[model samples]
Target: MLYPNGWFAVCLSSSLKPGRLRTVAFMGNELLVYRTRSGRVRVIEPHCPHLGAHFGYGGKVDGENLVCPFHGLVFGPNGVCIGAGRSRTPPRAKLDEWLVQERAGAVLVWRHNKGKAPDWEVPDSNMAGFSAAQEACFELKGYSYYGPENTADATHFMQVHHLTDVAMSHEIRQHQMEVNLTASWFGWQIKVRMINYGVGCAYAESELPAWGLFMKSYSFGTPIAPLKWTYTLLDSTHVRWLDALPRVLRWPPQALVGALMHWLTVKEIRKDFRIWNHRRHVNDPKLMQGEMHIAAFRRWMMQFYLRD
Candidate 1:
């Protein structure tokens, strides 16, 4: 499948501090990500238009501009070259800037095969409770579309995760899909509400009212190469009464609870990773009656892909 065009996370917001630069690979392209002294984040093609030097390796942030290490060339956040050592700015001397958004403690960049502007924006980071402390990344051999599409595959809850009494319903909107799932996990009833915005980003919020536990998780997948992609998962957990308890007494137990929840979520994804890593894409899937949404999801996903 062609890479889906949308906003896809590249790294955690915490990873890039002010006046810092980092290199990241996304959608089969190398990008230089940096934060200006003013605290604005920028994503641009890594190669310097002056002499083809990779800026990500030794790029320096000068106030709000990026300076190339190779020849001291400077470029602004808009990617236009200002000058190099009092020299005149050359025509067409600029880097390609990508549309970037920092949300939910993650850095997301918009990607279009033909450089088209993003049609929709990522959801507000404040919509759910997410913390940078609880996050994990995994490298997997699979298409970038698999993770978000799997969220609507209702049958997988019982077959893959071993959850019982599984029930799921979904509604598709202009730029997002909402899925609600109710199931029994180890005798505890859990309800999960997930919203997939395009194929690159999805957020799932899970609640266990009986246990006073609440979790918000975000999943992002970006293509690194053909049949290869990187998947990142981040989640934050809160215990109901713990928040009201005395700080001194609640610290240890709350930490333990959050850690356990994070571990369990990772374990569940690892199980799915195994299946996705080795499976082949079946264009004409022999799905059962209950698997109608799987086909519908595929049709929706195709809209994000560019045609020749």
Candidate 2:
């Protein structure tokens, strides 16, 4: 499968520390990921431009430059070699840098097979008052399309999550899509809104006003290998009572509620993991009524994974 041209996450932002270097597997290849002493995140091909030495093997960061172990070549944040070991003038060498952004507590790398610049940006999703992200990642034997398609699937809620009276609406434009769903889960009214920034990342918010419960979730579909990928979900919960508690006494309750929410959300999401991994695409199947959005979603995704 062709990796879609979009901003895909490689790792969580909190996982990388300043002046630290490491390797990450993305789009079926290993890429070097590091943070500078000044707290800048950079992603580049692991191999050094000189002698094809792997940066992840013995690379170190000095201030804002990456020092290669093979030749002691120092590369600036822009990936240009400025100093060479035991030499006055550095040889002509440069490391190719990948476009990267840190947002919503994740490190995202932009990919365009045709070498085009990123025309769209990932929306900042950090919540100021919400609890810290509770994250989990799982391997999927599927393409990135499944995540967005699943968001547009309305009938599945009744069958899978045991919801009733489900209705969905969509607003799509260019590289963004929003889906709103209203339903009843065992007599409690609930509403969910999903905003997808392309097909790789999506934000979901749920409201249960009657129950005084709300939740926020962000999911990233990252390609790793042919017919193989990873699905990561970051969830946070906002309990109404937690807000009323004193600042000094809120941490424990907030942490407890957030953990419970994360567990429930993960358990519910696991129900779809089996279907996503084992399911096959139906190019032209006769979809049931109220499934037009699924077809539209399939059409909307074509722009991201076009044929060369």
Q: Tell me, by lDDT, which candidate is best.
A: 2
Per-candidate TM vs. native? 0.93, 0.96
lDDT of each: 0.84, 0.87
Model 2: per-residue Cα lDDT over 1-308, one tens digit each = 47899999988888899987879778889889999998999999999988999988888999999999888999987778999889858888889999999877789999989999999998886576677789998888878778878889998888888899999999898999899999997899999999889878999999888867788888999988878888988888777767788877877777788899899888988999888898876778688978988878888888898865
Clashing pairs in 1: none
Q: Which stretches of candidate 2 lie over 4 Å from their true place?
A: none
Per-residue lDDT value at 41 in model 1: 94
Clashes of 2: 0
For candidate 2, the per-residue lDDT at 227 reads 80
TM-score of 2: 0.96
lDDT of 1 by residue, 98-163 (tens): 889988778999877887887798776453322224778888997988898888898898999998
